[model samples]
Target chain A: MTDAPKAAPATNSRAGTKKELSEHFKTYKHVWVFIECEYGVIHPVSLELLGEARKLADKRGVSLAGVILGSDANLIAAAATVCFEHGADLVYTVTDPTLAHYRNEAFTKGMTDVVNTYKPEILLLGATTLGRDLAGSVATTLLTGLTADSTALAIDDEGSLAATRPTFGGSLLCTIMTLNYRPQMATVRPRVFGMPPREPGRRGEIIAHPLNLAEDDIVTKVLQFVADRDSNQSQLAYADIVVAGGLGLRSAENFELVKALASVLGAEYGGSRPLVQKGWITADRQIGQTGKTIRPKLYIAAGISGAIQHRVGVEGADTIVAINTDPNAQIFEFAHLGIVADAIKLLPALTEAFRKRLSVNRLAS
Target chain B: MHIVVCLKQVPDSAQIRVHPVTNTIMRQGVPTIINPYDLFALEEAMRLRDLIGGEVTVLTMGPPMAEDSLRKALTFGADRAVLLTDRFFAGSDTLATSFALASALTKIGQEFGVPSIVFTGKQTIDGDTAQVGPGIAKRLGLNQLTYVARIVELDRDANKIIVERRAEGGVQVLETRLPVLITMLEGVNEIRRGSLESAYRAASAKIVTWNAAAAGITDLTKCGLKGSPTIVKKVFAPTPRAEKAHQVPTDGLAPEALADAVIAEIFSRQPSVESDLVRFSAGQ
Candidate 1:
């Protein structure tokens, strides 16, 4: 129920006193990234964040630190080594058996403790399922502002972290600032940033901290982890060349044309978010902001309208070819090459052409 | 084993279109419906309630017109519906939105009982951030299970829940405690239609309406834009690419010639695809 705002008791005798702007701006410090680790391997997005953090740290003349919490010290150390090679200057670790698997209760507690103890001005995390689960909790517990799925991060003239991200279903981009918050927090999607080259000989300082949490204190238990079978995996995100279908394809059977083209291209295949919503494709094959971000060398978008969410996902491609019947389809706006034609007719023709071309090239070679 | 579902009335995204001349979203004549994803959540919640023998309450936050969505929820066999509407609640982002929902949940707990579980769709099609569910869990201190494809088991008496969570590469079978917030993925369950009697009851049901002052929100600054940290300063249409598609002429051309011309264009754009095709054919 709504209630009227109550009058505040004056706790500060100098409530009206003005403070100097220069003195007020000195609270910001080093940038910190939340290193998301599960099972044993660290999520690539975590390393990617570290790489971006390294650039921001250099620009701001500050150190890049990584915050990691888990059960095994050795695993954390290994992760820290990878972070160092990617770019972290220091790794703050909290180890406890309760943290072996990700439980919001324990992971949030461990992370908040690290943040409060070491007041980093900027914090970054991967926008993965586990990272999102923990980032919101930790940010809320600390009563700070957080930006999600940021596409860009920069240090402004005021020494504040400015996070730019797509908004309103990728219709627009907005830059958000947490001016009053001590630590500016953000979550970035995978593959949005390029991975830095690894230097195995690189090293960083590891600050081992005690995790006061225990197993009994943790309320949730990990009964088991059923890793998705390799055969069932979509591998859409890692595809070098992706052929995606859209509503323009018309029927479920028509999707086979896109698949045939993808087969000849030797690329993974997917569809627009609309197709997924229409039940024509599974969620795994949906290529869009909410679905997947791909960085293929080439992308063939057939019958897609190219909404902002879908555009953001494929903007990283080196070359994009769009095939659609609508001359003014949004897909053509962003495509490197566009054809105004029926995908149903063009798809099969394209597939056959590729088949013959490759066979002839093979014979000649 | 009572379950509470938080639903939102969203503009049908598929119907949303940008003005041809102005290049701005024309929200006019866009019909509002229960967010498509939320329907799946409601269905899963109802199915669970049927199996576990408990009441299901459907709650929504929107303009007064959103009452229609709540009534629709009731037609789907929801035991009760609540609508939290207030002018001050407008422009609330996910952060402010979650804070308001969390307070309403507290009210629901006092009146009925603390829900054994709370459900929301993975994300609203309009927002597409998938943050509000996590935001609500953070405020209420609920165990969050997101992207849940299946609920493997639930033992209320033992305070346990096992679910198969959809992850980037695979599914994770996680076991957590009750009183958790779960954002159900699509394809978890198909929504069932209500009988005639249920539809009639929904049509005439007096869905409870609450304002900001009545929802137990004491802080005015934490209710709407004041409470939200993120702000959208600009909105624009996507920029068009610089080049047009290379057309393969089919006029007066044979099928084989047309196919060859198209192939030449594709190879001219991406020569490396030839080698990739070689590898693929080798497998075939």
Candidate 2:
């Protein structure tokens, strides 16, 4: 509206809800990871968190504990065993029929109740949809701090949980700290950390808790759970080698060059977010902050102007090879190898070369 | 029925640039637009209001200049626009920001009929935290449904809402009551362009501006930095790796020759990739 604004009362007053930092938070101890278990399967990110939590717990001279909420006792026990093998020194279980599915009300209440009863200095969760849903509600209910999509976590000299994440649209990085909040909370995306080596038959202490919530009290009801039939095709996140193209390919038809290269190398193929939006690639194949976070052994990016969003997703790759005609493309800063050439031309050449090399080896074999 | 859609005016991240030497965000010529994601939320709310008899009030908490975004929302057929602005809100993190917005929403409910549903984009591009929607829901004690892809059913008489939520590997059909908070996933619906008559209406629409006090926020500490639990201790450019990409000279080199050279470089750097490939090829 270009019309004059109807301003509030002239008094420049500052008044809102006040939540004081608790003084007894010093008593908070140990590092805890929320073991995200749904449909009797544990999310890999939960185990990855346990791996990193083990290091942070060790640094603080505290035990690494995992809090698992579920309806079935057998599932909970099995998940606890997996947590122990992954790195958890202790497991906190809350078994309630209401806690079976990831309804925000029950899970938030269960998670907050555990934190309030047994105060943990740090609480970690996966940045998956369910984890984010519960973490935000629980953190707000507890009046605590929570950093989302943290790329790194460490214990500072003063023992605060320092969570680092991309900020300002991923153009810059900032390190955030919950200086005075109990259960300094953070949510990390999957594949940001390495999976810890599993120890078979590892045992951990189990502390059972009750989720005092009743089914009637929970407002939201789950009608049905429909698993994606083609979920297996979206293996971009777990692929060992990824070859992706970008907008610079000129047209959707040219994207086939990327697939040809990937086919020859026996690798996965993906593209930048623009390609997905342009309908050149499916949503699952989009790689970036909003898309899948990938940590492949080898990543080849063609014609992609590595924006901040794309950088965060592929930064985890061990060795990145960039092919861009623009000499100053941002991907070169992070790529291990660079070729300043047109991807459309170079991709087919690379595919032919790889195919020939492999075929020659086939003949020898 | 009453609907409230939370909007944010953010620097077009596409135009935001970093200083080459100092690494400071250069906000000089960067234009501000309604956060791209919030458009889906706005469009969805408008659609619901058109389907059911209701008013859609677009709300935002930012500097006074954020009214531009509110006006933009009005042009897109929002019935009303409310701006929650104050200097105290500067440097507010997601938690603090949510507290302020939640307080404002409570006041809006008191003034205009209590909202049946609140809407926000899945996340803001500037902060990208995605905590505010759930934070507001928890503060207001509303059911929270995030990353909602579709609203399957909405029965005003029954006060029931069914939605398809995007989960880890599937779509979850969830049923909840009225007065819930939703963060709509992107690409759910495209925003519509206003008609000429709607443009004229928006041009004269008076934006209701509220300060912290007017929003019925009773505590000063929680309105701004003092309320935030997390502190940004450092902001810096990502440190460049120890070494940059070793450039393969492409001058006058044929595509095949360049490809061979690049392959040589890859094997030299990561020998395992070559070995892994060879083993896989032999197995095939």
TM-score of chain B of each: 0.96, 0.95
Instruction: Tell me how far the alpha carbon of residue A265 in candidate 2 is from the true structure, in angstroms, after superposition.
Output: 3.5
Q: How would you encode candidate 2's per-residue C-alpha lDDT over B81-163 as one tens digit per residue?
A: 99999878776777788899999999999999899999999987777778999999999999999999999999988999999
> Which predicted model would earn the best lDDT?
2
Per-residue error for B11 in candidate 1, Å, reads 1.1
lDDT tens digits, residues A76-163, model 1?
A: 8888998899888999999898888787888888898888887788989988888877777777777666777777788877667777
The regions of model 2 sitting more than 4 angstroms off are A1-22, A232-234, A276-279, A359-365, B275-284
Model 1 lDDT per residue over B101-123, tens place: 99888888887788989999987
Q: Please give the lDDT score at residue B20 for candidate 1.
A: 66
For candidate 1, give the docking quality class from DockQ.
Answer: acceptable
Q: How much lDDT does each candidate structure score?
A: 0.78, 0.87
Model 2, residue pairs in steric clash: A15-B217, A16-B219
